[model samples]
Target chain A: MSFVQNFPFFSIILAMFSGIVSSVLSGKKARNLSLAMIVVTTALSAGTLAFCLKTGESYTYMMGHFPAPWGNEIRAGVLEGVTAVLFGVVMFLSVAGGMTHTAEDVEDSKLNLFYIMIDLMLSSLLALVYTNDLFTAYVFVEINTIAGCGLIMIRQKGRSMSAAIRYMIMSQLGSGLFLIGLSLLYDVTGHLLMSPAKESVELLVDSGSYRLPLLVIMAVVSVGLAIKSGLYPFHYWIPDTYGYATPTGSAVLSGLVSKGYIFLLIKIFYRVIGYENLVGAQMINVLYLFGVAGMVMGSVHAIQETDTRRMIAYSSVAQIGYIYMGIGLGTTAGMVAAVFHIFSHSATKALLFISAVGLYEVSGDRKDFVSLRGAAYRNPLAGIGFAIGALSMVGFPMLSGFISKLLFATSAFDSPSKMLPTLFVLAVSTTLNAIYFLRLVITLYSRRREGDKPLPPNPVKKSSRGLKFAIVCFIGLNLVLGMASQPIVQAITDGLAMFE
Target chain B: MDVSLVEHLLLNIEETVSIVLFGIGFTILLLHRNLIKKIMGMNIMDTATYLFLASKGYITGRAVPIVVDGIQDVSAYINPVPSGLVLTGIVVSVSTTALMLALTIRLYERYHSLDLDEILILAKEEEQI
Candidate 1:
């Protein structure tokens, strides 16, 4: 009845309402309005999270007062609260940092539309993370997809056009398969609300009825989301989409979009299907296989990248691998680690993208890795930000990535068979991360003079204050996430307790 | 393997057809190089999913899902849930299809080609240059 519970619905409604309102307004006004909206909503999300944590409360608000089996539901727990806060903060910071690029990268006419899509995307993401109805999840998933494509193609460049087409085709394939899975699920269970569906699913599992069809449904749904999230072999479209978009788009795509899908997968595993049922099904092995392959091969590809942005995009594929690997461990501690990695990765990647934009602008708008050589010297603030981000990504001690890796390692000890391979993959991937990330860091700080032309003064020079503040926030976020890992881990454990 | 169970499944021909449509859609999506055909494949797949959902709402002898005043017996009418879901799916699919076509237009305008392979090759060449 109070702010913590009802605000979830209000957040979504306000986002969509503002999206529509801003789409018709002038560009500058729309930008200011949307910024204000995101900031206030973010503050509210933080407030909600703090309230829930202090009260140790979780709640479910049924739509239209029909209650679960017959009505839509949205459940909020510690996990969802933290997740909403993470999504909000990263989006706010990413957009705020990339404003200069937004003004330049997107055409004037499409700016309002761009802000509209951002609002819609934020709305859909909140719903995706909160909705307890499968059909509601699916609808919001579509909204997020459409909004994501809008963000990519707003540039109207040929490369971005091709990239958008590829992205649409691939993600559509994903949603199509996802839809089919949902249809099969509904067909079998005769219910779409997660709680009822879980009841039916548990009965089926206990009775061992519809075993094969249920397994097939599980596979289809996992595969659909896997493709959407750019896991392993399905990652062909990720780089083109992230690499060619505006810097802000790349940041949002890498940091938030994939994480949203992963969050849904976590929801499906824990809430709808039940964790015990998942172990019985042996479906996590599929995730494990793809995730391992993505880690090794995705990093290898990143090492070969010529474009700086594409390199970071490829690194994302590998980071996604780590999250899936955590899922594959199929333990509560492992899931907490995975979710923690999501938070850490979002902060680090947003930092890197923002820094990369500064580097690119300093290097005369060049996106290629070669041109950015020594460009870091031209922009020291971004340079420092990127260095900190790279070190964290490489899992240096006392950084956010280190905590997640440590959690993953500790979680690995609980599952004997998973221990060795998980450790090996973790070891190898960390080294590979060092290889690519270290090389970039070295190149940034190297003494070699930037060739071909005297680079212009830092392009962010015109409005460096906000960008500088955002980068500093990134640094502080990463450090704080690393050092203050105890309470978050405890919170995650408590939140995950609600799953059972 | 009861003969009656098999017979019941066989009698449900529409779901089978939807499955077949899904197969065709996946095949087109995977094998086709033409971007438009791939988009068409995606639509076909969405249609298959919608049909699958619609069939789930079907009943052997039930009336439509329009509830009249003072109705007491619920089993007299078919399930309306899947129809509502399918309606939403159709709208989402139509909008996505529109966006895909718009992207196709932009692609064709850029590379003067409709084939995905050609676009990739050109993109790679641009990368090298």
Candidate 2:
């Protein structure tokens, strides 16, 4: 019944090993090994998920069995359980989609490194989520960030190097500010453990001499995290990076890398500034301001974007806005909604990006709007998957986005401060989201003109059996998950109850 | 506020002045467009972060955070964790800077220019077509 005792963090260990092995293998062997690894890992992840769901135990893994508030601890509680399940799902799907590319696009020299970095990224992210120690979490963050850069730079062509460099530079700035925030926290309270750090800060706040230190630390850390989360005013790097990277790389980065930051943000906010203390509500306003700004700005920019990848990149910025909005509400429902949205957004967006891989492969890599005039007619499955992702993003009924946003809006109405403005902001942003994503959907779905020059024979082979089946699997999962949102919502609500 | 000796040491005039200068250098980094010059500014900023951490460790009579004085009774020395973290951070920053420089060289080879504006123009032109 004890999932942690049963799971033994084996998925993460296996992930790292598989990544290394996959990178080393080549030709038929590499493909077969990767497939086997994906199947085995997915089964292991599912076992972990089932055990957690059944027992509903908040499991804590103490590395070296050290006492917390002094030493490190990794907790596999409800939130961690949900995250693990999401990680498992993403890994399985990405690998399935990646099988298509491996047959043709992969360079034998780079394959080993690619698989290794992917595994390392997943394993480090798993570690980051489990650990409650502030310093340890930052270490994991750095590892994941660096590994992500490695994945992007593996391409070593186009703007990938520049994209990777920019990502690296920005991440360094974020890491520096994050460290400074930690330093400032250490000065105020000579502890690295999050719970005690919160206690010490609370004690100082009551004393009143070091209030500014708390504010400074909050500002620095928030800015640093905002850079990673691609929140407004710090989103300059995301579009270019996502646009330039390989499709698989972009999918994983968007799906998982940013989630690492969001996970840490939730932890820091919960552990260091407990929900009860945050009821004073200035942080809510800040979230609302930036959330709305990112939503509106990102959506508007996406509407004008001619490049499909760049447009999707912009849409991610806006989708993250919805998550931040949920956080701003600061209720149990809001937090739960935020977590649910994270799961749903990652799934749907990864599918959308993977679909683009199919299109790009066939069309010889044209990403601009004009080039995609007859794409929907050529690849109906991809066109349909993009539409579903777009619809979910716009919060259409029965889709995953609807459930999360409805909960978020309900929570926003109950917010203690500036409720009307918050509601207005979310509503306007949703409308804008529909406007842009619908445009993409409509363009892709409409019939091609008869007079249009016959599109050239696709450069790459039409979707192979394996690739087509993978796309179908994702589309099927998206539909089923949409129909089955209630249980997921209930699980999130149960998880958030701990914070309350 | 009940002031400690450590706090008084941290409030030193000369160190504070130099910290201010370091801040100015990093601020200049945000304004400049010359990639090489901006990198130099980043190094300046990196030095400031290191100084800040080291200054926090200073106490009037404390020795360096090492066992040089004696194996036993090391509590009187400056705290070592921040210094250790900073050491790693510095290495990371150096490697990142090196990588960025390499990328800049590649960009120059492609566009035959080092100026950000020129490269951006070329990129935009490509995108337009």
Candidate 3:
């Protein structure tokens, strides 16, 4: 294939190298270099997406030009195409937001390391999504985790340090379990590729001896990934880290990093396990149960949270649960809904985080609902962004979240199992979403008293080209893409067809 | 001496011993209270993985995985892939250990104790902020 064909992967490597070079440069120079890197990467990703659409053919690029099965391979099929596009969108938005906010926070002393780690994290994410080899996927997972940990700890703040340490411990445990599960498959099949190992496992499914090992392996793998993905019981660390990290860093984590593992989970459970196997067994039911539980539990917790970032973090857990439920439904429609939710959530959530930065920049403190009483009136652009994002998250019709919810609800009702309990929980949670998010929306848009605390000095000027471009581009996506939801849904359906 | 029988017995013994070692390490990791000891258990489990990988590539009377001039060639060499992977794994484990140690030191500095309970209390206090 031509270099253009492999541009996505190449762009990532170049970005990381550029970041490393920029890190060593002076602060002002580094800012310019990071902005340049962001532009180049955003262009490359957008170009690759365009190419994929033009070709309408799935492409696989093997590392070192080695063939598949023996060597690692990166496959960019329909699902990857849609995800890559969404990834690019979020990345552009994040970089845009960061270009202004981060340039000011990143001192010359720490600039190089930050850029390098960011590049590594981004590259690893791309690799994780594209690679078909489970072992190679694990390597990418490590790189992502380490880079993430490094990002969080770059500041020696007590909370950042502790949170980073906790994340590192949890990640290591998850990685170990994941590696063990991979080893079990490798032992049985002598192959590291996902497809063949899955096929070989199916042949041994009937053997009682393999059942325990398989269950153990699945438990290990699922729990590990669930922790990483912030599924219900494993989601404790998310708010702590996201709440403390600079807004830009949190955006990357919630928008891109978590999605990486989540995509892998959807692929593994639905594709590798065979939908028949999953639906026939109790696994699907179990998944649905956990998902609904997370939905209810997360929403309830979010309702109680007053911290803006913490509230968003809780909402993420609940949102992930929604994605889980769609996947658990184990139908073509369900997978489509899940992927749709992923795309919509990535856009809306990034929009929210970026807006949160804008609000933080203006008001200086993001601690409580009372502090943000007239924020909407203060910055109309950020106010509308927040409102649209909140409404979309609540799954209001004509918005992106509505489609995902409708698909999920339809899939649940259509299943032979007819999981009414999960359906009820989902409805309740959506209502609860209105309770929390609407509170913020109303608080922002409401009238302020005459004696209300005066607005804090706006530290961030709305002048950076990258930030303006990122926010405007994402908001445009929210408006334009929300109307054209069918094509995105169709893309997801095509991607999920592999699982079927 | 019954050389063939001895070799067979030793091979079985190696497998059994390595499995036992892994099990013990895991048990300690699950049951331990001290965080440092838990890390020690993790190291032990890693050592078992190293042993298992090396064992997978072993053969009776085989030469080490080395490339030399013409004389040392031919069919007497062991599989090099597992050994090579094990080396990579070792380096990764070392990095993990270093990070773990750094974290432990930081925890010590914060709470002035290695006890998880005290650390949990400190974490809770920090959380209320």
Q: What lDDT score is found at residue B108 in candidate 3?
A: 79
Give the number of the best model, judged by lDDT. 1
Expressed as tens digits, the lDDT of each residue in A283-328 for candidate 1 is 9877888888888999999999978789999999999999999988
Angstrom error of the Cα, residue A255, model 1: value is 0.3
Q: iRMS of each prediction in angstroms?
A: 1.5, 2.6, 2.5
Q: What DockQ, between 0 and 1, does each candidate earn? A: 0.68, 0.33, 0.25
Which run of 10 residues does model 1 chain A get worst, by summed lDDT?
A: A454-463
Clashes of 2: 1
Candidate ranking (lDDT, best to worst)? 1, 3, 2
Pairs with steric clashes in candidate 2: A23-A112
- Please give, for residues A1-500, the per-residue lDDT of candidate 3 as tens digits: 75667876776677667766865677557656665666676677667666766776667677776675677766666677667657766875786676666656555487566666677776777777767778778777888888888777765556776677667766766666676666555655666777777777688775535666566666767777877888887788788777777666788888888888889877777545566666655666666777788899889999999898899989999998988787778777877788788888888888888877666655655457766877777667778778888988998777788877888888777677656865787789999999999999999888766886665665334535655566677777776557888877776776676443
Candidate 1, residue A35: CA error in Å?
Answer: 1.2
Question: What TM-score, computed on C-alpha atoms, does each candidate reach?
Answer: 0.96, 0.89, 0.88
RMSD of each: 2.0, 3.6, 4.5
Give the per-residue Cα lDDT of candidate 1 at A411.
96
Per-residue accuracy of model 2 over A1-500 as CA lDDT, tens digit each:
35445453676667667766766576456545555665665565556556656777555566665686556666656667677667667766766675656434457676666766777787777777667678777777777877888877777564666677667667766776776677677767877777678888788767876766677777777767778878876787788788877777788888888887888888787778666555553665587678778878889888888888999999899888878777777677778778888888888888888887776655556776555665766788777777888888888877777776787777776775746776787788789888877877776666666675444565444766655665677777677667898887877766655433
Compare the candidates by TM-score and give the number of the best one: 1
